[model samples]
Target: MNDDSRKAGGADQDPFFMRDPEKLAANLARTIEEAGKAAGFWSRARESGMVSDSSFDPFADMLRVFSALGQYWFSEPSRSFEAQTRLFTAYMGVWMRSMQELTGQAEPDKPEAKRPDKRFHDPEWVQNPFFSSLRQIYEVTARWAEELVERADTLDDLTRLKARFYVRQIIDAMAPTNFVVTNPAVLRETLKSNGDNLVRGMQMFAEDLREGGGIPRLRQSDLGAFEVGENLATTPGKVVARNDLAEIIQYAPSTGKVLKRPLLIVPPWINKFYILDLNEKRSFIRWAVSQGHTVFVISWANPDERHRDKDWDAYIGEGIEFALDTIKARTGEDEVNAIGYCVGGTLLSAALALMAETGDQRIASATLLTTQVDFADAGDLKVFIDEEQLQALEEAMERKGYLEGGRIAMAFNMLRARDLIWPYVVNNYMRGEPPLPFDMLYWNSDSTNLAAANHSYYLRNCYLENNLARGRAELRGRKLRLSSVKIPIFNLATADDHIAPALSVYNGSRLFGGPVEFVLSGSGHIAGVVNPPAQRKYRYWIGEVHEEGFERWLETAEETEGSWWPHWQQWIEAQGNETVAARSFGPDEEALDDAPGKYVRKRV
Candidate 1:
């Protein structure tokens, strides 16, 4: 037949009989028929004792199919009701088998067997017929809905549809699945291993529910906790520290004499400064105190909205300047050794640079821990600091008068979304398991807000413009230049840090025009800095040439493992004045009272 005649005949044929239409209608009809058949089969199976009354309910299965179809239809432009219905049925079938196993029901094909391990016992909630049925129904319905959504061809449309939900699914799917097991037959073996894990997870959830807890509280494992030096708490040394917002805690050493040079610790306002004085065994502060160093940490005041107006200049003026002056006044010394951590480190660098520009030399030595003076290569976080994102974030902060800590945490988490966010999704939702409490997670959750002005300025200038590395950064109208501050510098960075990559930290040595000792610690950002010697999980690489780049120095430097704190101690001791004398910054200012300063205490 001619093409035109064939086309006319095709158009004239029954609409339902057309190729595409027929296929689609057939698929839909088949889905509805199968769904009805499934309902009947389940009902018969229940009556035939193939599935226990407690494990299977025909009504619940119907609800799941209805819910899945409803969701699928509601998704307008992208519809897959039949496909989703099939997925729903498949998921329900699997869940029914699982429920049967938990409810002491024996399948005709395979007999039920009891697990010998108490840890593998099914939870009471899982055994409860009502809860189990409801859970399976909901899970199957949700999974099917997700399957429908995931079938979309375009990410752009998916992003606009349910952006966060789709992002989470994408992240979960992409998360690391590889393990170090070498056996070729490990897949089947691992399934057996997973059976026990599933049971254990179920039991864990039941216990938590029984106790009215969502997650188990985590404790410092035996291997995680270590003691600090004995001298950490020996005496109420010349330095008396107080947290006005919290309580006053006195730290004294047994030394007959304090160091002639006073020490001032500048910790990032983001975290508590106790990391330096973590415990008796791993405490760097304790070790320094034993070595007769007159040390004092600037416990930042956790600020609230009341202190929203406080800018970077104010932090330098009232915070570091105040601490430095106080130390100078107390010790009767003109200069003090300053140590800064992370943001605190950057602030110290700025302060020193500003001081040097004005020819003020109160800072004798600057030791920066996991600190970044140049933000040119600031790692993964750079992605979120792009112009568009920064503008949106700035607008957000302007409305709130501060950058919310939760927002900042979210940004950080995005750098490793699969690791940080998706695992929780799989455990909490997919597996019906509760989250496990972790101290690090607790600390991470306890976040602090950043002042609106400071955050906005920091992003626009340092991260976006690369001002710090370019030497165009300014503090209070004064151009801040690291090279101008020719002071002895000690810069330390961790190898696996995501926030401040080692390469970025290493670039600091080149930025400074003075003698720089670049040390590479073995750990992530926080862990590396909080590392105490007792853990024995740290290593460091140090290079002698202060002017050379990190890569060049790495080629010549020796690699060594263990805490680098002792090495830092030796470096400080070598540069610090040997004489022991009480040097006070000023008369004990009763302005604030101890560990967590007021600024840190302010809620995000």
Candidate 2:
């Protein structure tokens, strides 16, 4: 890092850039020398009529299928003349667009004119004629490839899914912005730094190659900007209870007279729980405390091979079940208001159903944020799920008895490539600049691993089979059903959420046999939930509870100006009448430290 940034330090104190000028300079020299060779290769490739980004060959995708089949001699792919014809037509269309571009009268991409894809939203993309044409034609080609694969008659669903997966991956990889020669931003950065950026980008790439097994996940220096308890999850709280399965945290109440019923937050174990409890400015935990509600959250164990056998039954039994018990015991309340985010909400729903079946009516109400119990339309994530894919994932997990965190992260990141993936590539690898320290992103890069059996069970039962929505899912030998959940449900779905897909969350709420007040937040998964009134950022919509679907609700629902947290507080507060004095914090044991807790610091 530069001398100034080096002293900026870790998350303990506020730090910004995690860059070193000297190392960056040395790395850029070597990077430029290699890039010189790659540029030569690109010139030759251009002469050969291979117009594309990426240092590697791009045309292999069409014929790449043949190479795969040839490698597996015994395997055969059914021929589809129609599929071939469609692809040929797509190529011809691309050529026509290219010809138009040469004549300086490129036909406007009509489909995109109606509704443009945000993937190429950068002003520089269209600001340059060459880049604009490249982007338009590339997108046209990508859409065609994805559609044709989806409509392929000869390919099995799994094969087709995998093909589409590869198609998107290839398209994302080939974006003009990825190359320094093509990207204006990178070019400017290169010029400004006088080759330092190039050196830093190469060093970053090499470091990623060494540490990430070829895929650079996060800027390590940027990640070092924030420590868990000190900066990120710095809310005042105590690990009131801990178990082998999870850590139950009860945040100190900010109010004098708190709600009679404690609020229990069940965050998705796919991620750490601190997402809802990050910095105090945006912390839902701190917000809840300030709203006069005693908040409790589950800090899931970062599972390793030793915890491989843990399954659906175990998560339902030991995860939420244990948290509920601990919250009830500690708060001296028989029943508590439960809140779940993403998969944590899903698990909480399952546990609540199991509790209902067994006559444990300990939950007075439930709130689900960007979570779905129904997986009938689980969005793009379904592409990586099914018997075939699950088997493949299982085999991979078998190697370590746990699903690799990065591999799992890839599927989610793919959902919004432009937002999650590419910006990092440009910033860290292209500009030789590290990320600006942001709390939400810090929590995002800080990922946790998943157990083999638990993940498999979740996929097979939830995503692949759609058992949870059907009310046929079973946990711990008990027939579980969302219909069994009778608590007043506060269902929050983000309008722009790619992960939960507001519609899916809306669909899941229908399975519940209770009065569910559905609220549609303004943005995607994390931002939608992290909406604080202070920012006045995105607006949310809320409709009357009815049988109509999401689209209909959007048409008729009332739009609200700011954050939905206040609305939620009003709704939740109405659930109970009396209030009691706030309770104290801290666990009886010594291991678990302040707010963020030790479990969050446990990285895989």
Q: Estimate each model's TM-score.
A: 0.61, 0.80
Error of 2 at 460 (Å): 0.9
Collision count for each candidate, in order: 34, 8
- Tens-digit lDDT track for model 2 on 358-408? 999988999999888989767778766756557766776766678756656
* Tens-place lDDT digits, model 1, residues 1-604: 3334546888544222234545435544544454454455546544764333342222343344345444546667335556756876777685767666655484311212431222112232243343344344544454555655465444343132333343444534442221102111222232434333334333433433322222222111221232212222222333243433222232454477776777788877666565666455656677777777777777665555655677777778777877766666555778878899988898888888889898888898989988887786676566455565566666666655666555566556656555565554345422434556444454554456677776766777677887776788888788988888888898999998988889889887688878888899988887887777778887888877545566777788778888888888788777875776543334555434333334334433
For TM-score, the strongest prediction is: 2
For model 2, the stretches where C-alpha displacement exceeds 4 angstroms are: 1-29, 32-133, 143-166, 188-195, 213-215, 585-592
| Model 2 global lDDT (CA atoms, 0 to 1) | 0.75
lDDT of each: 0.59, 0.75
Residue 263, model 2, lDDT: 85
Poorly placed runs, candidate 1 (over 4 Å): 1-250, 424-440, 546-548, 581-603
